[model samples]
Structures are given as C-alpha cells and as structure tokens.
Target: VEAPNQTIAIEQSQSDRSKKTFHPVKVDLPGDQITKVTLGRLHFSETTANNMRKKGKPNPDQRYFMLVVGLYAVSQDQFYLLSANVSEKIIVRASNPGQFENDSDVLWQRGHVPETIVYHGRVGINTDAPDEALVVCGNAKVMGRVMHPSDSRAKQNIREVDTNEQLRRITQMRLVEYDYKPEFASVMGIKNTHETGIIAQEVKEFLPQAVREVGDVACNDGEKIENFLMVDKDQIFMENVGAVKQLCKLTNNLEVRIEELEQWNRKLARLKRMSSLKSTVSEESKVSRCSRATSLLPSKKSVPLKSNKVKLCSVKIFRVTIIALIAIMALCALTISTLCLLSVHDRHFEKHPIYRQVVELVTSSSVALSPSTTTAALQGESTISQSTQPVSRIPEVNFCDILPCDKVYCCPIHLQKVKFLNYEKTNAKEKRSRCHCINCNFIMLLSKISEIIKKKTLFLIFLGIDTTISSIQILETQQSIDSRYCSKNLQCRSGNYTYVIPINKYTPMDVEISLEINTTEPLIIFLCKVTFGNYCSPYSSSQNSRKDFLETTQGRQHIWTLPVAKLYDSAYYFRVAVPGFASCSTDPYFAGIFFTDHYFYFYRQCN
Candidate 1:
C-alpha cells in the first residue's frame, strides 16, 4: 500500500495462517529541511476489516513498534542512524542489508533478529546526564548494590595493574576515622554512627580510580548541594587483594631464610656430635690396643712378643694421628661455619640501610673510644697507682648544662667548672692593666702530694673566662710564694707550642691542651700563642725555649699540643696570649686545659 504523497509504502505477504509476515515499509521524504523519516508502527489486529486503525491504543496481544531509521542534520551534514526492534522488551537489531526480506515483519517475529535497545537522548536518576543513560556520562553513583552478569572473564584489551610497587603504594595509604558531613548524615540517617575508612583525598593520590567526585540536586527541598569525593569499595577491595598477595610473598621469603638458618644450625650440631664421637672412639681404641699388647706379653721377664709390641706401637701412632686430624678438621670447620654465619648476619642487617648505619656508627665509636683511653693510660708520664687504675667513665655532659645554648659535646674529658672570670674590653690594643686578660690563678695541689712527689705527675687546669688572652704563662717553682712571682726576664722564654714528643722515657714532656674560642663577629682572624714552662731556674743556667705548635686564623674552637722537656727542680707553667682580641664583653668564652693521664706525644687527644 502507498501512503499519501507517496512517502511511505507498506507491503504484506500473502501466506498461510501458520506463518504470517509483512514486508519492510520504505519511506522517502524529499526536502532540504526534512532530514529524517520516523516510521510509525501499525498493529494489524487493531485495524478494522477494510481500513487501518487510527488514533487508538492497540490490544494487549497485538505487537507493534515505531522505529527511527535515521536522523540527519541536513544543514550540519550530520546523521545519527539506528536500527532496532520493538516489542514488550525493546531491542536494537544490527543493520545488515538483504538480511530481512521485504515480505517479513521483523519486529513482530520473536527471536528472528538480534537487537539491543539504545536511547539516544539524556536520562536521569537522582542525577542527570544530558547525553547518556542508565549511568550518567559524567559521574554515576549507586547507593545500593549494582548487579550485573557474573562474567569477570569478559574483560578485553586489559593490562594487569597488579605489581609489588602498586601493593607498596596501597600499603602506604592511611586508614582514617571519619564521618559524613552533617547535611549528608541527616539525609542518610547515619548521624549517630561513626565510620572508619580511608579518606577519599588521601586515597586519590595513590589510586585515583578508587575515588570520584559526585553531586546531585536535592529533590525534597530542590536545594543545590555541593560535590563530594567518594571512594569506590570495589577498587579498594582490589588494592587489598594486591596487598595480601604481596604480604604472602614476603612471608614466603622470610620462611625460606628461617629454613636456611635452621639447616645450618642442624649441620653444625651434627659436626660437633661427630667430633665428640670420634674423640671417644680414638681413646677407646688406644686403651684396647694397649691391653691386648700387655696380655700378649709373658708375665715373667721372658722375651716379649716383638711382633705384638710392634703392632701395638703402630696402632698407637695411627690412633694419635687420626685423633689429631679429626681435631684439626673440627677446628677448621668451626671457624669456617662461624665466618659464614657472621657474613649472613651482616647481609641481613645491610638490607635495612638505616639500621646498618646505626650499627656501624656505634661499633666505630666504641672501637675508637676504648683504644684511645687505653692508649692514654699506657702513655701517661706517671707510674702512680691512679695511672694503673682504669680511667673513670663520666655521664654524658651537654654544653647547654654549662652555657645557655643548644646541646654540644666537648669530648674525651670531663669539663669541671674550676673558675669563671668576667671582663670588659677597654681598647683595641692589649689589656695590660691587669697581669693577664683572664687570669685563672689556681694551683692544682694534688691531694696525693707525697705520691706525686715520688713520681712525675700531670695536672689539668680548667679556666673559664669572658675574653681572649694575649699570652698564657705558666710558672713552676720549687717554693710557694704569695705575690712575688711576676717578672719579665725570668719568663722561662716560651714561644709557639707544639708536641713535646716523649722520644725517651723522660726526655720530651708531651701535653695536649684543648681550647674553645667564641667571638661576637661571624668571622675573625687571629694568632693564638700558648706556652707552658719553668720560669724559676734554681738548678739550670739557661731557660727552656720550646716553640713547636702554631695556630693561626682560627674561629670557634681549637686544640693545641705543647710538649715540654723534663727539667729538675722546675714546676709546670701555662699561659694564653692573643695579639689583637676583639669580642663582646658579656659573652662568656671558655678555655680549659686538661692534664691527660697519657702523654700523647704523637697525636692530639681532642680530635
């Protein structure tokens, strides 16, 4: 049949009652504006005997569907062409020319054409997508479960996201205690309950696919709500799976290492047992051979069996040789095993780089400290009882304990507060008004003076002062004087100090002095001259002049070693001098001299 204007043609097949079908309807429209032709469906059973039904709904049993063949934007030169079937359940049939005969009613026939129903317009749920359906084109959220066909293996063009690196990232994700906002909680009716889960923002850094931003218009109040980040439980579950697998692999590696250690221990035990058994066997064999040789000999002084004696000697030699060999072998095996085990232990520690560094640091410190102390004791210039005893260990002291500053270590010696002197800088030149800039005139009269007198002794002079001294002078005399010990000519003629290396047991009197200098200026250049000697020469005709140590342009703190020659009827002296000293008047600068029990003639102890 031809429609008005000859735009649509419908052809019906004349067939038996058992097999009934209709031909395809061809519609043609010619116009620049009319770019599409939407063919309406016609239900045959609803039609009257002579004409087709119009403006009426079809019966429940009648089958009909309207199909949009093509939609062309003629002005834009664009077309959206689709082919589908219509029934109680909609389906889209694939377009294959000549697959459907002109006489067949493809829509009415069930299971004749493969189809899928596709909506080309916008679809909305709680949210709306202007161009997509089922799930929004932007972001879709399902409050409840979303069921699908159970076909996990249906994925294609897939690349595995499983990796140890991914697992590590997942493990680093922080699980947090959180709750929904009040607005969301009220809508969800979960305000009273506290929730624990990963934060979306935090997880987004590691696994972006697991988190999504979602927003929707409030329906009840028609209020606009802000977008919020939501985490996908499925992605989180996948990450968990990866983490569990990684942990399993790690556990396996640990188990393997443990097994190796256990095996090594078992072997060591076997070796020990074997060695003991061999020793016992050798001893028993020696005893048995001797008894046999004795029984084979005559009880009286008759000629003993020479053969028997020879055999017994051979057996004794063989037994001794075997036992010696076994002992040597056992010792070698033990040494090798011990080295192997130690190597394994070292490797295990090295796997944790930070921990290994800590271990190495502690070990090196212990090694350096103990040897230094022991060497000092051995090199001390005294043969007294105190020298023989172990050097006393003191608790760790911080610089802040003595000064108002951050923690700092002086090192190797206990800093005892002997004396403190404060002063002000009067000029740029030397401060000669006083005998010395910071004179800490304190004598260390050894408590065991009688013992000290019996042998040469070392002493420590701790002096804390505010400014630098131009020169340090030590006066050692036979007799004690109250205030008659200042003279220019009898100054013992000391100069730049160096190690007074003890070449022999009593020649060079070596001493190490450690000093700390702090200046108000950020940088300063100065020469420090430290001298210690005997100014009073009752037994000697000439004064001792030892200028070996020189320190120039030093900032912060420095240590100097001054070695002196042992002289008779002379006492020890110390002095510090600064040529041009410029510093704050109030800030306390520290200077300390320690008489180490050891004469470190070759090395400085403060370093």
Candidate 2:
C-alpha cells in the first residue's frame, strides 16, 4: 500500500507453517514516505527524530552515516550508534573531483579546488621521501618573505673581519658569465639563460667561506647522490664592503703625502729665486769698479806739454854754471820727497791705534776685514797722505799703475798664501813702491772685505739677519751710492773640454767675474778679452786672458771671485776647462758668471 502523510496501520499476515515458520505482524505507513520500524519496544524520541529530519539535505558541520545494520542506544537526550564496520574501503571524494577518485589508498581529496591543509607530521611535495619538515623538489614562487633564524643567540664565535685580508682575497676571485645546462635547468625548473656570478671553484681558493658544496638532489637518483659547488652571494657582498673601507684609508694617506711634497717644492723654488738675485748684484759691482778705473787714467791726447829752449850754445861756460845750480836744487827736492814718503808709510802702520787693533784681530782670528775697519783705514790713510803731499800731486801718483796686474793682493797682516793667476812681471822696485802706495793698501783691504762677506753668510744669519734680507739691504745701500749700478748673470755647463761664453759690447767694462762651479774634478776658469777675432782660448797667454786653477778633492760646490784685470775692450769671453788627466763625468758641471757694475777702483782711490 502507498504511504501518504503520517497515517500508520498494523495488520496480521499469514505464512505457511509447513517449513516451521510462524506468522508475523506487519506495520505500514499510508501517508508519509519515511518509514520507521523497531524490533523491540521503541525508545526513539520525537525531538531527536525531528532534528535528524531537518539535517537530511547536507551539513558540513555534522556527519551523516548510512548503516545496513547497527545497534543504537539513547541515554537521556543523546543518540549513539554502537559498533559498525564497512565491508571494503571508505573514501570521501569531492563532488567534481578531476582525474582522482575514491581508492583503497587515498583517504580524502579536494581535486583542483583550493583549500587549507593542516598536518602534524612531515609533508613532501613532488618527493616521496622528505628529509626536512617541508621539502619542495622544484622551484617555488613565494608571494611572502621566506625567513630564516638570524638571532645573535643562534650564532657562535663571532669576530670582526680583517678588511685588508678580505680585500686581497676579493681581488683574486674571478667573476664569470655562463648559461645553465639543459639538464640542470630542467631539474631546477629554471630557464637556460645567461647568468653573472663568481666562479665557486675560483672563490674557494682564496675565500673558502664564500663557497660551499651542495647536492643536486633533483638530478640525482635514489641510488647515488650527486654534488656541485655553489657560491654564497651574501659573503661576497660583505667582503666588498670591507675592501672599500681599506681603499679609502690608503687614498687618504696618499693625499697627505702629496701635500707634504708640494710644500717642499715651493720652499726650494723660493731659495732658487733668491740665489739668482744675489748673483746679479755681485756682477754689477764688478762692472762698476772696472769702469771707474778706466775713467781715472789721464788720456795722452788730452794734455799737451809746451817746452821753451834757450840759446845756451852761444855761451857754453855760462849755461853750464846755471845748469849745475838747477841740478843741485832738483836733487835736494827729490831727497826730501823720498824721506817724506818713507816716514809716512812707517808712521801710518805703527802709530795708528785702530790699525794696530785691526792687525791684532786679523792675526789672532784669521778673519777677513770688516766694513767698519775698511772705512777707517781708508779715511786715516787719506788724512796722512794729504798731510804729507799736495792734493794735486796725490792724484798724479797713478794708483792703478803700481797694483800687481797678475795677482790678487791680500793684506800682509794675516800672511795668507798668495794665489798667483799668472807669472809675476813687475820688478822688485815696483813691488816695493806698491807696498808704500796708500791706494794699493786700500785695494787690499777692499778685497778682504769682499771675502769676509762671502764666507761669513752664516755669521750674518746668526746675527738675526736672513741671507735674502741682508742681500736686499746691500742692494738698496749700493743703489743709494751709485744709481748707474746694474748686474747680469751668465750660466753654462762645463765638461772635460773647454766651454766658452761671449760677453756682448753692452756689458760693463768694469764687470766683476764671479765663477761658481759644481763638480768633483779640478777645473780652470779664464776671463779673456778678444783682441782681434771672436775666438779666445783658455790656454791663451797672460796678455789676453787671466786664469785661475781650482782643485777639488771631493764632489762639492765651489765659488770664486776671479781676480781679473780691468776690461780694456768692449767685448770679452769666459772660458771653462777641466784640468788634469781625469775623464769627464757623466753629469755636466754647472758654471755661472756674475757681472757686477760698480767702480771698485774709484771706491778704493777716492773713498
């Protein structure tokens, strides 16, 4: 009969008793399609049945089960099903599972649908046996950051890196560009594109900490594991940082050293400039002295002597008597002049207290004459000469005529060795006369003063005067004395053979020749006045040139104020030659000529 709403009916059904079966009662529902049957007294509640009926469609929060045969128990308001077993496997499959179905092995599956998976044990993806908590055999694309433990507590034996060592090792590492192999690319799921990185093998040689060996698990089979080298990019980056720091320190040190060298170069330039100025001043002074000496000599054409002749031949006896009387008066006058000059020379040297003091100072210390002593000596000698002879007669004495033309005469007080540039040509009588001349003595004093100035440069500095400042003051002082004073310097290099430098017509006639030589060998310097041609040799006779020999035992700088005669011609030449059998040095020696424009002759005779 059909079941409609909820009406139920019970009827007794007859069964055959021939097979030992008995008749059973049957209950049937007529209205509702749901059927409920119970073997013993029914204990099912209406509320629990109604709840099960409401959940009949589908609910993820609750579990639903269909059993063919099971024991059910109801205690208080709870419903429980006692022991149930399935005949085969049990699987819960998705509604539209694709390529996967319920099987004896898989317990659950969600197919292509995205869902959350939570597991307490290890999980391996694309790998059958995972060695870690989570293992991915191929490349993984992560949308979030992948973090590793980096706390200080996790590390041990931390220390600072040596930047210098790191820099050296980094220089040794070789960087390379290469493409991944097909097999490697396929296993790693990466494209076979060119990549830039340091070679792991090369880096291991210098910086092993930056390199490591890693297994190529994707390419390896289960039987054997294959390994390859890998370089850690982070380690290289750290090394580069340390290297940069070391380079900065080295650059700073180089900058400081460069600055120090620049300062020294500037100082040397200043000193060179000062030396040039001093040489110029000295040359000018020499030129002036020669010019004054030339001007002081009286020209033979300027003054003419007139003679008157008497007719004494007509009366020989009368003329003879008058001539005898004149001759006798002339002899008496000559004897008186001789005695006066001899007494003056002795009195000047012996009686003067200042002269005595100067003699003592020179003999004791061997120091050259000072400027003050030179001035006093000149003034005292001029006074004595004026007292003994008339002013007009003093000028006629011809001071330059008596001076030794071949030698530099120094004062006899110190008795220093006399250096003769040429053979002496003056007679003994002339030498005696020169010693007696006031002008000759003054010239000797001036020469000594020039020597003192040259050798006592350090002494001037010790007295709180720098050489440059003292030189400038001397220039100013001399300029005040004579405005015509000027100077020039001629520089050249000398070798084993002779080197010549020409002096132009514009050069001063009284120019002083100061030679400075830098060499290790002996050298001879000559000042020659060309008489006829443009050429003048250092080996020329004393009539044309004056020469001085300089011998040196060591490599040193030598300066000499050459004792040259007064320049008679408008043009001259300077000749330098290395003396002796020594070969020329690889390096050329330096030679410089300083021409000073000042009247040294007039300064001695007048001042």
Candidate 3:
C-alpha cells in the first residue's frame, strides 16, 4: 500500500558483486542446527513464524527445495514475509511499520497460511482488487540466499568485530543460509554442488564420480577419500564373497522358517475340519437316541429312564460341541501366528543384514585387484587371511544341474543376490539405497567359466575408466536361463537375449561400436573377446627361475562371456576397441581380465 525509505541495506556481500545487491534485514539465529523460518508481511505474528524455524545448515551436496514464494502484501514497515519448509514457522514484521491494523482478524487471517504462490514470482496476499504489488517496482528485486552458520571465512571477521549487531548479522547470515545449499551459499569448504548432469544426483549428496575417484586411489594425505587403484582387488573380492555367503545363509534360514509355518498351517486346518465333522456326526446320533426315548416315556415307571436318557444326550452333545470349538480355535490361532510371521518378514526386509549383503553382492562382483597398493591398509594380514577366503578355495557343488533344487546359480554371489521381491510386503523404500558403495569389490561368475580363466597376477587391479563414476551401470548379470534382463528401452526378444559379440571368426567385425557414455568409473558388461597369440604364459609354480618363460600354441583361440549385469552397472561406455594381437609373449599377466581397449592385446595398426 505504501513505499518505505529508498536506501539499500548492507548484508554480507561476497567478492561476487551480484550477491551484494540486496536490501537486508536479519533475525539473530544462534547454534548449529537445521532451521526453517517463515517470513510474514509487515506486522508481526509471534505464534506462527517463531514456531517454524528449525536448527542447522544443510550441506550443499544435498538436494532440497529452498522454496521462495512470491511476495505477499507488504506491511507499512517494509516487510515481505515468505513461507519456508513444510514445517509451519511464520512471522511478519516491518522494521518501521505504518500501523495498518491491530485487529485480530487482519493479522491472524493472513498469518494462517501462505496465499496463492506463483512459481518464481512475488508471493503475497491477493488484494480485494488489483493492488500496488501489481505496480512491480523495478528498484525492488525478490531473491533469497542461505548463509553458512560457521563459514570459515566469515567466522574470522565476525569474531574480530564481535559486537551485538555484528554478531546478530553474522548469526543472521548463518541462519538465513542454514537451509541454502553450500554450492549457492558463500561457504569456504568449496563443496561439490552441481544442479544437473550429476549421475546419482538424486541418489546422494556426493557425486558417485567423485566418490569413486576418491575410492580408486590412495588417500595418502590422511584424507577420508582414496582412489580405487589403491584398493586391494583380491582382498575386496574375497571380502565381498564372504558377505554374500553370510547373506545366502540368512536367506535360506528365512525361507526355512516360512516353509515350516506353511506346514503347520496345513495340519492345523485339517485337524479343525475333521473335528467339526465328528461333532456333527455325534450330535445326529444323540438326536436319534432322543427319538428312541419318546416311545418309552408313556408311563410314570419309565419317567426316570426317559429323563436320564435326555440328560445324557444333552451332556454328550455339549462335550462334542466344546471339543469341536476348541479345534476351530486352535486352527484360528495357527492362522494368526502365520500372519504375524509374515508381517515380521515384511517389516525386517530393510533391516535384514541379508538384504544389505544382497545389495553388496549385486554392486561388487567379478573385480580384479591391484597388488602392492595401500599395503598398509591391511595391517592385520593374519586376521584378514583367517577371516576371508577366495572363491576358488570355497568349493561349491551348486553347479550340479541334476535336480531342480540342486540348481543354485553357478556363482555363489548370484545364487545369493536378492531378486523378485514378490511377497506382499512393507519396507523402507531402499531401492535407491541399493546403489553400490564405491569401494565394494566382489567377482561373480559361473563355476565352469571360473575354471577356464587362469589368474596370472598375485595382485591384479581392475580399474574402471569412465568420465563420471556415478553414471556407470553396475548391476548383477543373470545366472539362470529363465532369469530376467531389465535393460531400459531395449527390445528383448527373449529373456535370455544378451549383448555379447559372437567371436566365431578371428576378425569378422570391424564396425567400432562406440559406447559414447560419460562416466568416471568402470563399466559392468558381459564381454567376449577372442585372439590367437603367443600370449604371456604363467610362470611355473614349481619353477626356480623368476624370469622363466614357457612357449604355448600361438595360433589358437577361445570364446568367453562374463556374467556381470547379473551383478551391477557402474560405468558409461560408448566406444569399444578390441586388441587384434596375433602374436604376443607370455609375461605372466592377469588372464581373463576384461579390458575394453584399456588393457590386454590390441590390434597393431601396421605402418
């Protein structure tokens, strides 16, 4: 309705000039907690706005709405209170308010809730008719920014110039910015804050790419983040295998309990039905005796016998009815117990360690390890050696295809991975949470396939080369002929249809299939590459010479496929280049390492 003094207020302006331009007023907010404050129009509402403010500043990496509604009616004191956060905390006060109305209706009604809010526009109470907010003054701009409560850069200045108003200003800066993310806020930590193109952008605050990069190498600076290269491939794989084994055992136990409950219910139902039928038969027989007693009750001499027979029939009928009812009650009790068991099963799905283990197995499968990297990471080698065992050492008879139940997925990890959550259930919506942690390393493969490849390195490292690690598709490959392959937008003619290049001929395909993917992590794909070469042969286990080499057939080849998507999706790839090496020497290199143009034999471009 009216305009206040035309002077710009000074807030903490940053080095960037755009951030410095706003007229500012602050409420003193102290402490490190999540806060949500709602600003109302000119007059103050003590009840609503004061209640809505929460404590603490949010980390910039996270995604939450810093919702700014359009300006409501400004009070004479030049205040435009805005609603914030889902929780209700609303306040409206002008620095020097022109007393508009002290009536309860004016303040309380406007204070009830926010009026019509236009997206990215001034939020305000709609005038009884088109009012002055329509004038839309060019001098006034509506923008909001959150401040870091404990900004290292701002903290120093505030402490030096510590005054009540200065302290309030600093505290207000912190309070205002508590909800704003670090990326847009002027905090010194330089947190990773990109609004778009962040894979797992919705997944978490940390870019999966950044985390993977940090995980792949060593954190030598004593920082929390380390790269994947620094991680022990074999050790991680073995540890993951152990976690999967534990999960499989847990799953089997839950299944057994379920089966037992089923059996108990079947017996209980049958017993109740049988008892009811017997009761019906006995009651009929009792009624027949009563009919027989009618013929003998004509004289007084027979009165005593007739009375006794009637009494006996009633007693027998009552006893049989009670027994039948007891059986029915027992059956009902069993059914209730079964229902309770199922409820427990559904509720614990997220809390179950087996479920978490299954997530780990899907994320960490068939990874190669690097040796001599982060040797100190495993300080207690004896402890790890005692605890974790390689997949090779833990022999499984699950590959036996003789019977139905005997057919466990040839890979122990796949056999244990959770799928088909078909039980009518309720659980924490953790489908997003199932994404793999960056450091998980576990290998999964069919048993026969596992025997074909010879591991050449005591320590072989599998490096995922993607532009952004978060974009990588790391998922479990199926182990069964009937399993489902859930690829997005793919025309899967059959359930078993998979994308693997057929390598029947030595050099049949020349079209480079470029997987123009953007990721900074390794990819999870089923690859088949064949070559005829004098590849580096493994050194003899019993040979005394360290540099000893053995000659092998230099012109023979074989076809191979890794079961991976049955495991996880971790990288993005668009270009795939295969090595066309016809001849190479045995250097005791890692065998069966799936290197997409990054490692292994390459086709030499002859000059």
- Cα error, residue 24 of model 3, in Å, equals 99
Per-candidate local distance difference test: 0.38, 0.39, 0.30
Clashes of each: 19, 27, 92
User: What is the per-residue lDDT of model 2 for residues 146-251, given as tens digits with 9 covering 90 to 100?
Assistant: 6767899999999987899978987887778999766555555566457887777788888887777655455533333356676788888889999999999899
lDDT of 3: 0.30
RMSD of 2: 33.7
lDDT per residue (tens digit) for residues 433-494 in model 3: 43232222111122223543444321122221221112211111212211122111111121
Error of 1 at 30 (Å): 10
Candidate with top lDDT is: 2
| Model 1: lDDT to the true structure | 0.38
Model 3 spans with C-alpha error above 4 angstroms: 1-319, 334-350, 357-607
After superposition, the stretches of candidate 1 with alpha carbons farther than 4 Å from their true spots are 1-34, 37-156, 188-193, 216-225, 271-607
Residue 336 accuracy (lDDT) in model 2: 51
